[model samples]
Target: MDRRSRPKRHEESRENSRRNPTTRTIRREAIRLEDVWVAYAGSGKPAIREINLFFPLGKLVLITGPNGAGKTTLLETCLGLLKPYRGKAFLLGVDTKSRKILEARRKCSYVPQDFMKPPYESYTARQAIELGLVLENTPDKNTRVEWAAKLLGIEDLLDRPLGTLSGGQQQRVYLARALARKPLVMLLDEPFSSLDRETRKTVAEILRNYVDRENTTVIIVSHDTAPIIELADTTIWMNEGKVVKVEAK
Candidate 1:
């Protein structure tokens, strides 16, 4: 409170900001839904109704509920894949209903629940991961792909045909593909469904590290939240097409 120390305090504050710029900038929500309602084609009722949610950047969010809880619908709506029939949805501040939503979606990575390949399918795991690097002529594409594969403990499987691998191996390859992209936001559905308990914990930690180092947002939809509940910054519980509870750590 000393007037004589005011200039010193200002100098210290500026130094702190210089050390960590994120502290000086206001954190913003990466996804927001306001009174949203979404339904599939030919469906008279909305799968997710009267939903309102917001998630900030650089956070890991978990969405969990029972089988018919509409978790997947809400996740898709966040990415603008499912248009809300009754209200507004936004991704990174862009209106979901706008044509520009396509551009917004390019900044996100999505992994759906069903990623199994047919037994005869032949795409190598490496090739699948490379596809995620949509940007052509990227000098570091190989490095990124390799790093992601190794990080997921699938480097040896990279050369194997995706369909020849086991279900858990295929899942790791898909996750590697997503991680290699390093998108601003990640929308993952049941990401750990195929992994064993040990693998699930490892993958969750890897994702947490990614969120911390890259300062990106990850939203996961899962029926089993045990693996990620401890790492989540926020958890949303849904039931009967509605968000019943939200817990923030």
Candidate 2:
């Protein structure tokens, strides 16, 4: 084309660009770790080494392994609760090492491996659940809390002191607390540890439905995977602080 024609073409291209703006690639993963390694204070060796993971959005992922497999460490590292000494970790596209990690974490929920309350703890189940909304400004906070409790069959225990409940009941309360937030991501450690077979099945169903309904990314660390395996979209196996296998449905 002639130089005059080229300028006209360029102008047309710029106009088209302005009309459509810019199109960027959609992020597929909510959590990603690139060759991550973590070590606790005074530890002889790293808890997790050379860990690489990618958890796609709206997927139910299960991390399963025997005790001492660094499952808990992996979960904490993903949330920036434990920073990686080497490599990188990202949550919802924000680097875990960045100062903005906390801001990214606000959109997520975590249920630790130990949720049992001390006997002196006086918070009721409903109060414990409501605490999940403290950082949020939801107009329907009470409705969300009640709905989560009812889903876990813990509405009756709403007024009961958390410390006074049975282990399984407390576990349900904690689960309800995390669910009530409607977080974009959920990291649950040993979610079925204290539940019976029936309760496990029920909780699994509830989680599956929640993920489907909310399009939330859920990463569950469980030594006992039978209850959640069927519903999980991906399963990651770890041993000796390394991912040994990965299975996806």
Candidate 3:
């Protein structure tokens, strides 16, 4: 082979390596906050202050604190829904403040504290679950909806209108919706608020299984941690908008 041809062949080999699926790298931190602070309008103090936290992939993290302790603020900051007054937040290696964060946000699913709707609102459990996949244009939408409903033990409630269901039932439907997305990172706020003791235990086991099977990151905010405490890899306690302790369990 000619010398010129050898260089060209070497360049082509390098290009092939770059495009190889096996060569891809994974970021270690699924969610990270660096000295972050977030404040509400008309409030002199920040809701979360000088927080530095890291949540790695494929682990269950529990955040627990009293009301007004900024657990909600911390979750929102991680998702880029709340802008930081100082420092930075990153989700899946994408800076939360960056415009490109939308791409990262799409890889996450959130179930907020107030997911229940009024009795007059009319949307079936199946329809609500489908919406999560629909928003992302996920393929095999029907299959995913069915899978989520079954996983959450809500198959019987699928055709029932969400408003007609009890608060606990509605919570399960919303949780199914979040799971249908197959998200890389899950942020759940007060997920077990309305659940009975038995249902809470079931949901906690499901969440643990999800993290193990999918290799995803899960961050949960709850006042009652009994159901999920055993499954947690790390527990973060916050008070007055500051993380008072982070313990590995």
Candidate 4:
């Protein structure tokens, strides 16, 4: 083509580019479980059965149910800490039973239901929080710790030994640890169990803010949902190891 024709072609290309801009597709599921069933050793029944669940990115999910309803089992199964006896569990698109599950877990932060430390344990609250940051090689770890502590109203306890603190206090410390990591996925099992009403509200606000600002995918298991119910994008109700209801707000 001549130079004049080349100029016209370039103009057409620019118009086409404007009309068809390149776009990236984001994966919807941060965690997925397909027909999962988890059973304890020598147990006659599965702890969780016929479970199929998906947690999308950038949303807060609340899992609520009575005790012995298999809420904890579901969370553990999603993290690959408990293998599904009958089905598949995936985290960040990687199968939970695969070797790459470790890599997938690096993008996750978890606070278990029992966060209390033994009296003989020696790590300070600040040090405990540091553990989460270590997996990600996060820079400015100290600053992140401070920020999380302050957010959780635990700044004064940073230097206190974790084992020396009360159960409620320990819960806050562990929550701060999880938040400091800034993980893409966060799983908290009965995180507010030991917290008082006021602290529960405060922590719930912190979690809601994190989800909004960071687009973090959060799955929280709690028997009490008042604190977080308004903030959850989805609420899952479980009974007898099955998800009986899923309500989207």
Q: Which stretch of 10 consecutive residues in model 1 shows the poorest summed lDDT?
A: 20-29
Question: For model 1, what is the C-alpha lDDT against the true structure?
Answer: 0.90
Please, what is the TM-score per model? Answer: 0.87, 0.88, 0.89, 0.87
Tens-digit per-residue lDDT, 1-249, candidate 2: 488799888888778756633211125668999999999999989999999889878999999999999999999999999999999998988888877777678878899898888977899999999988998877999999999899999999999998899999999999999998888899999999999999999999888888898889999999998889999999999999999999999
- For model 3, residues 1-249, the per-residue Cα lDDT tens digits are 588899888888778657742212226778989999999999998999989988889999999999999999999999999999899998888888877687777778999998889998788999988877765765689888899999988999999888999999999998998899998899999999999999999999999999999999999999888889889999999999999999996
Which residue pairs collide in model 2, if any?
Answer: none
Displacement of residue 2 (Cα, Å) in model 3 is 22
lDDT of each: 0.90, 0.90, 0.89, 0.88
Best by TM-score: 3
lDDT of 3 at 57: 94
Question: Which portions of model 3 show Cα errors greater than 4 Å?
Answer: 1-26
User: Model 4, range 1-249, lDDT digits (tens) per residue?
Assistant: 488799888888778657633111125678899999999999899999999988888899999999999999999999999999899998877788888788778778999987778997899999999888776665689999999999998999999888899999999998998998888899999999999999888899899989989989999999888889888999999999999999987
